[model samples]
Target: MAEIKTLAATVRSGTGKGAARSVRREGNIPGVIYGGGEAPTPITLNYREINKLIYAGHFLTTIFELDIDGKKERAIPRDYQLDVVRDTPMHVDFLRLKAGSRIKVAVPVHFLNQDVAPGIKRGGTVNIVLHAVDMLVPADNIPEAITIDLSTLDFNDTVHIKSIELAPNCTPVDKSNFTIVTIAPPPGGAAEAKRAPGKLCSAQAAESRHMLSS
Candidate 1:
């Protein structure tokens, strides 16, 4: 479990886009908190503190204790809008959480033991199909990341969402069976050539030949 440091925020009395822009000009990020049957509260947080949390790479799942106007509240990041050109955060949305409440959030997936995997040793490439997955978990026990063991994977072997071992009280929102990661022969190699008919040296080469013939 990864714990996120808390930040103190001040309630914003002003509203509208103009006010938000003014807050940004002062190096503060404008945010709103909703859910749990409470009225949305407009607030402003330190941009530096928010950036630090984003750099930690588990912003969504990491539990945050937001000190809003001196009142401590637990919340989770719901959405954040970023500037397209500068790639900086422009606006943020947070969801208020209650103890024992279940919330759905996307958690990052990490691959472990890749170097020791049998497939990689055999010159196979590991293809990741999903980087994150939505899961419904308790507010307090939300896992920062879901790790999958690649130690036992072999060539042509795949690990699916259903195969992952999830943390307690966490359940995948994706009910359909789906592959998360798979080990396959490298794109251009003897193994791939043997697998495909006509003995093409590589996928790109095969595509080029087809294009020329057509």
Candidate 2:
């Protein structure tokens, strides 16, 4: 499940380009909370705190409990704007979370059992096509990542979206079955290595038997 974090914010008294600029001058980032059937609430967050959160990664998918003047609101960050030149946060938008609500988020992809994979043992490389996948899941049960097991994969084998078992109530946003990962053969060729060892062993055994008979 996605980890929930608490953030402190306060109601913004004004709204507009001028107001936003004033908020920035005061070392705060202007933001809004909308959706979940409630009226949009303009709020201000500490610039330094928000900047840190944005750079920490997975800001969009992370759930936040915003303490707005002693009132707690559950939300997920929907979008944020950064200054093109400075790359500093300019504004942020959040979507409120209600009971039984579902939202689309890009969940990170994780791989398991790489060491046990036949492809990996044969010196094959794992080529990841999607680092993250969009999923629609319950707001209260958002998954941290979509896991793919590579234990059964072999050289040149592919893992498609349809083959994976997702968490309950989690559905991928993409309707089409797409390739997620591939086990690519090594440059010298994994197939050749797989075949050569058996042949070499057989030849060694034959030579040993001939020497013993002689």
* Top-lDDT candidate index: 2
**Residue 129 accuracy (lDDT) in model 2:** 99
Compared with the true structure, the alpha-carbon lDDT of candidate 2 equals 0.93
lDDT of each: 0.85, 0.93
Over the stretch 1-214, how does candidate 2's per-residue lDDT look in tens digits?
Answer: 8999999999998999999999999999999999999899999999999999999999998999999999999999999999999999999999999989999999999999988998888889899999999999998889989899999999889998899888889999999999999999889797565775546566788998999999
> Lowest lDDT 10-mer window, candidate 2?
191-200
* Count of residue pairs whose backbone atoms collide, per candidate: 0, 0
| Residue-level lDDT tens digits of model 1 in 81-194 | 878998788888899889789999888999999999877877788999999998898887788888999998887899988777889989889788888999987667536534
RMSD of each: 7.3, 4.8
> How well does each candidate superpose onto the true structure, as a TM-score?
0.84, 0.86
